[model samples]
Target: MKLSLGEIADRFDLSLKGDPAIEISNLASIDQAVHGDLVFLFNSSHRKHLTDTKASAVVMREIDCTDCQIPYLISERPRLTWANVAKLFDPLPMQAATRHPSAIVSDQAIIGAGVSMGPHSVISAGAVIGDGSTIGAGSFVGEGSKIGEHCRVFPNVTLYHMVCLGDRVTIHSGAVIGADGFGFEPNKGAFVKIPQIRGVVIGDDVEIGAGTTIDRGALCDTVVEDGVKIDNQVQIGHATRIGGDTIISGCTAIAGSTRIGRNCWIGGAVGIIDNIEITDQVEVTAMSLVTQSITVRGRYSSGTGLMRGRDWKRNIAAFKRLSNLFKRVRKLESERGD
Candidate 1:
């Protein structure tokens, strides 16, 4: 995985500030880097450590190079350059294009060229796996499911019947796609379960994190558009359509029938209620509860900031008297009127 500084600079369109022949064998943090390693300084506050770093080379902005003693590559966006560099050092092995002996593939299933099936994986009847895809151990691809080219379905992932995934999608371990949505009708002191008959359709380049679950729609397909990144343990409810390029952080819960717009950022642990429409480019901060539709695009937050217990108690008391205080102020203004 070694790369010369000149090669990295040319590939990433970065400016070379030092000897181009210097070879980088690995990547490490600025603090932990040894010789033959490349480090990056993305944060300005970390510039203080540049003078003392032990790395052979560094990736940084031109302004930060003044304090760097080692060979460095200049980039307008150092963090993004570092990300591209990290891909060169990715440790995951390439797919071998062979199925394990223990794998159970249905006779009616269509497996494409260069596909790899790991141990005990199942491909049900009428399923179609695209070229160069990898199905990891213990995964289950249900009947009529279609996985697109170069997708990776990690171990223990479940794609329920009729689910469709687009090209280059990555489903992490323990992810369950197209499970039944929660729908129950109240009847005479009892609850009757409603049938969830729809499937899920995921677009290209989407990465669903570990343990995340996307439920099938009750009447329509649950859709996730291209380039959406969903973090670990997130729950996307039935018939919800997440627009392209939305980023949903870990533990966020989006209720059924919600329409989230493009380029939106949903922070960690945010709760979005059912049937709400969130406009494009909206940003919902961490732990905020969204109960209504957002008509305008902007950053929205609804939660108290962290504070000491005693200060919180005082604020709660003041909040409880707000209505009465408003009434008293109105009366005082009425008496003073000329």
Candidate 2:
């Protein structure tokens, strides 16, 4: 998949500032690029590494050409152009409508045209697989579930019964969708389990990462709106409604019955408790615990920032004295009034 510098420039409509005959077999980072590799420079902070890069060519703005002695393509958005070019070098394999003999497809299931079911995959009874969808090896599509067009259920993924997925949804390996939510009632000094009868509804273009689990609700369905990107190891509890275009990072845990608004950015390892409403465009910082409802639209963070050990100890001491200090100020004000 090697491409000449001139060909790339002409394809992307970028200004060519170097030898047209130069070729690159692969794309790489600026620091790790070797001979015959393409690199990119977007931030000025990375300009220091440009001189040391051994790439055959680089992609950068025209102004950066002054410091770069190597052949480069001048682009308005170097990263976007580089990403498009990288796809050319490493294209994904196409999956056709061929069902592997090892796959188990139920006669009762309705599979559409151009669907690819891989080896050892199971399409349960009464399930509907839309056209151009790919069920990867060892995956399980449960009974009565509906998978929409062009969806990709990656290897070993499990979509439980009654789960619904929209078009172009990508579920990665080890993801468990429509599992039972954790529900119990204290009855006669013992915990009684509640039945989870709800399904999971995933909208179009939603990409769920590996090992993520989206639980089924106790009564209502768990709804994830379109264009949501969920990262690896995320745990979403039952009855949660995720708005469109929300990006959730890795290892985040959201409790049950929570409503996450549109275009939210939830950082890695963040914990959100149950029954809280997060407004639109809210950005939660990494590792923060959300204990209450976020009514306004803005960035939010909790816990203390990184500090030296001595400074942390001093802060802890001051926190302990805050209540006493408040009382003392109140007493002083009362004496002044007297």
Candidate 3:
């Protein structure tokens, strides 16, 4: 989709400093942009490329356009404006309401208008797929599942029994929703399995990334609230409640029964243990381990910063001798006492 500079400015409420007639066909990074491409300046490090950018028009904050030779659009939030523009040019295909020849949908299932099913996709008995939803190739919708309107379940995705998805939800490839939680009872030197009966209820506008797994609850529903964006390979355990608008980055593992509050930012590879509560607007940095509850709303981080290998080894050696050093200091203090 081609958009003129004036239309973008009007749509996004950005102040137009460029020629309104200039056509923008695509988006690119400032350093890599070519002719007919729209570039954005958000980071200070990328400001060096502003004068040399080959794009037709640039999007940047008003303060950064002083040295810009080319036409530009002024935005208070440049990155957000860039995202909105990118959405206008997104090239994802829209499938019609047709089932592939290899697709197997049960007669007992209720399929809504404008729904499409790809090859080898299966919709089990009592499954309800809402209007304009797409089930991609090799995907599975298990018994009693309900998918809301305009949801996209990408190829190889699995919706286990009784799973519920809200409107405009997007589950990428290989996402496994409503799988059984890890529960066992130990008796007589052996373990017995505990059945996971409850479902997973995902709220509206949630985007779950590829290869993510959300386990079904043992006692109640595993709930992911509205507008939560989960990055790839995240593992959310059973009965965990992720509050609305929380952003969890890649490789984060949230243990069972944890209650994460609204608008929290959980960084990549962060480990959150079970049964803990994190309050609203909390931010946990990457690689941090959350072992206890967070009641306050602020940024929290753990683990040491990266250093040279030799320096780390020296710190480790000093850490090992701390107890011995403390004992010697105590002895010296006792001898000095009159």
Global lDDT of each model? 0.95, 0.94, 0.95
RMSD of each: 1.4, 2.2, 1.5
TM match of model 2 to true structure = 0.92
TM-score of each: 0.96, 0.92, 0.97
Give me candidate 3's TM-score against the actual structure. Answer: 0.97
By the TM-score metric, which is better: model 1 or model 2? 1
Poorly placed runs, candidate 1 (over 4 Å): 330-338
How do the residues 1-338 of candidate 2 rate in per-residue lDDT, one tens digit apiece? Answer: 88899899889898987799998898889888899999899886778888788999889987777858899899888889977888788767879889999999999999999999999999999999999999999999999999999999999999999999999999999999999999999999999999999899999999999999999999899999999999999999999999999999999999999999999999999999999999999999999999999999999999888999999999999999999999999999999994
Q: Against the hidden true structure, what lDDT does model 3 obtain? A: 0.95
Candidate 1, 1-338: lDDT as tens digits: 88899999899888888899999999999899999999988888999887788899988887777856788888889888878889999988887999999999999999999999999999999999999999999999999999999999999999999899999999999999999999999999999998999999999999999999999999999999999999999999999999999999999999999999999999999999999999999999999999999989999999999999999999999999999999999999999992
lDDT of 3 by residue, 15-96 (tens): 8886899999999988889999998888767788877878898888877888688889998898788778889999999888
Give the Å error, residue 8, model 1.
0.6
Give the lDDT of residue 300 in candidate 2.
Answer: 99
Error of 3 at 229 (Å): 0.5
